[model samples]
Target: MNSSLLKNIKTLFKDTFSAEPVIIASPGRINIIGEHTDYNEGFVLPAAIDKGIIAAIGKSEGPDCTAIAIDLKESYRFSLKEVVPVKNGGWRNYVLGVVAEIRNCGKEPGNFSLVFGGDIPSGSGLSSSAALENSLVFGLNELFDLGLSRQEMILISQKAEHHFVGVKCGIMDQFASMFGQKDKALLLDCRDLSSEAFPIDFGDYEILLINSNVKHQLNDSAYNERRAVCEKVAAILNKEALRDVTHEDLLAIEDRISQANLQKCSYVIEENERVLKAVEAIRNNDIKTLGELLFASHHGMQHLYKITCEELDFLVEKARENPYVAGARMMGGGFGGCTINLVKKDKLESYKKLISESYKQQFRKECSFYHVHLSDGTHMIQTTE
Candidate 1:
């Protein structure tokens, strides 16, 4: 736990509401091998990480709710009976969405004062939005005794994003953040939300991310388009989803779709297989084999999915040259984002310096890096005064 963050939230709560507060920690997540497979109802390998969002919340005595975003230093006030998302999809939209979904689910939570913040890097492909949504819902569920199950909370969080935040996201982020276990990666079957824990042991290597910070204007539209293309192929093949379509099935219906859509469909099918392979390799401690799969996934994303940006491509190409780097690939919805890398412990510094210099020399913008580890999912802490 982040003691300073906890103290800060508690202080904010006390200073604002002059009362005790309940605290909860909701962690961000990283997909080890799966990329963009959730929407297709395929398999994904995700784990909750140590970096995450934390909330300190307390019920007020009125019908109005107030929230302070500790990091943004902004205040949001709204009525519990009239919660609405902010215009322009700001951060408050996430909170408002959660509140709306909770109410929609027949939970009439009273007015509350919430102070929330997180250490998860924004736009670093760490699912910070999910962290925030999960934290709020978890805190509210505990604070109000909503009597919602874990799975119910997960659905509410996902709906909050879709209906409130305007992002048609799959359930991977919420599910991972809610159910993640320490030192383990989840092989989630997105079709049915079933998962199995796979143990991870990097031995001499560590997981690090290199953020490109180059979100393009086409990110949203491109993502929706890619998703539509995949769905179209599935419909043409007369399958429920891409998960139901196999490699051979995709080929049988290749001429029915465009060449571009064919490439996209192929990537999803193969990436699903790669995720399962990655899990098997984890069971056998085949780190090198996992690295090779990572590289292959990156190739498919860059060429087939057409999601990666030049900065991401550059980072992967440069990272691949280092013998210490076992695996590297562009993460998140792509266009421009971070590349998750696995580096030998001893070569961590050199790898960072080399990637930093190469990235700067090319893009003229410094790249950011975050070293993360697998961690427990969302849970509350009883703070002892």
Candidate 2:
């Protein structure tokens, strides 16, 4: 738990409840490498960023669950006994969904009033939703004395987002939010639910995120269409997921799958291998090799996965053109979001200025940029003062 966050929680609690409330934080993640691979049951390398969601929670008197977002300036209330889907852009669905999942898993759910906000850039491919869901679930567990382990908490959060939010995402985001460690990136095998933390020792190098400020509507059909294509290709190959296929395997049955589906399937298969190599490079302290992998991953995403847009590509390309930038790639569900880049620490300001000017000139849009570090996952911070 961060000390400053703990202090904020103490202040918020005294103001809201006339007592100190338990403060918990869950981190949003940036994938160092690996994209479009989680759904295919492949590997991903992601780290929890310093930016995250913080929740100050305490038990409510009534049977209803209530929450207020200090950042969004919104308040919501829901009944735990009769949890119904909320209408009117209910961001509360994420919280309600967690409660529902906890109950369905035979665990008693507790009602609470939560006040929360975060620095994690929403819709910037930084897994802000996962941070919210994880923080809520973790806060509830601590407040209610539930003995759910970290893994169970992750599963509960994943179910909440999938069933309530209606996004068919893989478990990487939730898992990363729960298990991340400072100075390390999680090399996760989504197929086996196992993970190993690799050292992020990019000396004198920093990870920078540039948000194009273009909204990525996950509810859009483009995401679903890509998922459907992957599923169709998997079914044709008689495999459970694209993870089961290799580059050679795809080539062997290339004629059976449509060209579009083949491209999607092949990218996942190859990307999985790249993730392993990236992990090895990190272990070996070979930042240059890992940087090259980032470039290859971007190429695969652009040409094969077909997720990167013009804005995203231009940002990545411009960033890569900088001598100080080792690698750059678009980071999320795509269509529009951020590109993560590895830039020399001393050259960061100049790099940011260059990209900002180039992006403005090319797209007539200003890019939002930020520096991030690997941080601890969800934990409680108690403070007095």
Candidate 3:
């Protein structure tokens, strides 16, 4: 956890709770390589980062659920019996969504007082919302003896975001938040919901995230549009998602799709192959090959997917130009967000300084950067002091 965020959580608890409340944490995630492949039922390599949402929660006597955000300094209350959507700036939608989803699933919703905060930079492609939702649902699941397994909880949290929060995301964010393992990245098959863990064996190297600080609200619509286009192509070819199509299949009927849609379909198909190759590289400890795959993925995203922006493209290019960087690519929904890069461990500081100076000179905006570690997923702890 970020020390500042930890200090704030401690101060909030000291000021508000006469008794120590139960503490629960769920980690945010960084997609090390895969981009936009989750919805296409392709493979993704993601790890839960050290940064995440931490919640201090306690049961309430009444039927009303109350939650306060230490970071935003905002408090919200809702009736457990009558859950209604907040009209504006409802950052609490993630929490409310979970409650509504659990209730809809024929489960009883309970009341609680929750105080939460996180160090995960919002809009940095780190899945902060998923961390928040997963933490809250996990806390509630334990507090109420809901008897839900990890996968069940993941699905519930994902459903909450899709139905209540209104973002059509796949299960990846929730799965990583709930099931991440330290020093390993998860290879998730978005099609069958099957996954395997792969050790991140880049010796003497570390992952770094450089936030562009430009929030891309258009991501939601663009994501849906791309998904629609893929679906259209799939329908024309009489298949499911692009995952069903092989590279040869794509080549054979490449002209059946429009130029733009063909590019999209090809990226998804080739990206799936890249992901498999990345897995092999990791298993064989071939850092150089893995790095090349990262660069190739970014090129596909920039030229084919057309989701990458100038700033993100610039960051990737800058990182690639540096001899110390193994690989770099724009992560998450991405009109703008973060570029996930692997930098040589011994040269991390120098690499950061170089990138920051160059990025600032070119973009005229200082970039926010974080060194992240693969971390354990969600867990609950009872605090007694």
Candidate 4:
């Protein structure tokens, strides 16, 4: 947690409730590659970053829970007796769903009051929602002596997003937030929910995220449609999921599946293979190969999956022009978000300047940039005394 942010929330808690609250910092996440593959039960490479949500929480003396969302400046109250999900709860649903899932785990955290906020840029595709959900569960688990293991907490957090918040997101975000270790990236097998940590060593280079700042409302419905299309292709190929379909298999069945469906399923198949290749490239210290895979991944999303927007494409092309930029590609669930890039440390400043200038020239709006490093996942810490 940022010292200032902690002090603020802590001060708010003490002033409002006349008690000290346990502080929690739950980090948002970034996926290097493997976009749109999580729900399809494939591989993903992600890591938790320093940017995230922090909270000051304490149980009330009674059964009524209250929360203060400092960022939104919204305060909410509810009875623990009626911890069920509420449809119109808006952002509160993320918290209430965690409570509901915890109850299903046979542990109710009792009544609580919390003051929370974070520096994670919302809707930048850094998994801020997951960070918020994880922070609530982690704080509550600690507050009530729930004894929830990291893995169990991860599942509960995911269930919160799915069952309560009503966004059927995959497990990658919560897992990355709770299990990430500093200076390492997780190669997660979504099919089995297993992950392996690979050291993150971008020697003489840095990973930068350039935000487009444009989000289309079409993202949610488009996401569901793409998932359904993948499922349809998998059924036609007599596979459990699209992950089981190989490039050759996809080619053979091209005549059977429609052109559009062929495009979507093929992107998943190729993208999954590319994720493994990127893993291998990391192992071999083959930055060039890794860069190639990044570009290929972008092409798949643009030409095949059809997700990239013009702003994202322009920023990537600018990166491609620079010799020191090893790779750059659109990150997250596309339509609009950030492009993760590998820039030579010495050239990082110049790279940013060039991209920013041209991006402003083309889009007539300033794009945002984030410099993030991997950090340890969700865990409670003592607030500064």
lDDT: which candidate is best?
1
Worst 10-residue stretch by lDDT in candidate 2?
A: 1-10
Q: Number of clashing pairs, model 3?
A: 0
Expressed as tens digits, the lDDT of each residue in 1-385 for candidate 2 is 4456556655766687675578888889999988978888889999898888888988887767778887787888778778755764557888888888888878886778888888876779898889999998898899888889989999999888778877778889999999999988998999888998867788888888999888787756377678788887788778998888767878888888779878887788888999999888888878888888999899999999889899998988886677898888999888888998889999999888888898899999899998888988888765442
Model 3 gets an lDDT of 0.83
Model 4, TM vs. native: 0.95
- Give a tens-digit lDDT track for model 4, residues 89-141: 76698889998999999986778998989987767888888999999999999
The full ranking of all candidates by TM-score, starting with the best, is: 1, 4, 2, 3
Best by TM-score, which number? 1
lDDT of 1 by residue, 1-385 (tens): 7789889989889988999988989999999988889989999999999999989989899668898999989998888767877787577888899989988898878888999999976777788888998988998899899999888998999898888666777889999999999999999999999999867889998999888987543225477788788888899889999988888887787777778888999899999999999988888888899999999999999999888988899999987888899999998878876898999999898888988888899988899989888999999987873
Per-residue lDDT tens digits of candidate 3, residues 327-347?
998898878889988899999
Error of 4 at 274 (Å): 1.1
Return the lDDT, model 3, position 23.
77
Q: What is the lDDT of residue 246 in candidate 1?
A: 87
**Deviating ranges (above 4 Å) for candidate 3:** 2-7, 10-20, 218-221, 251-256
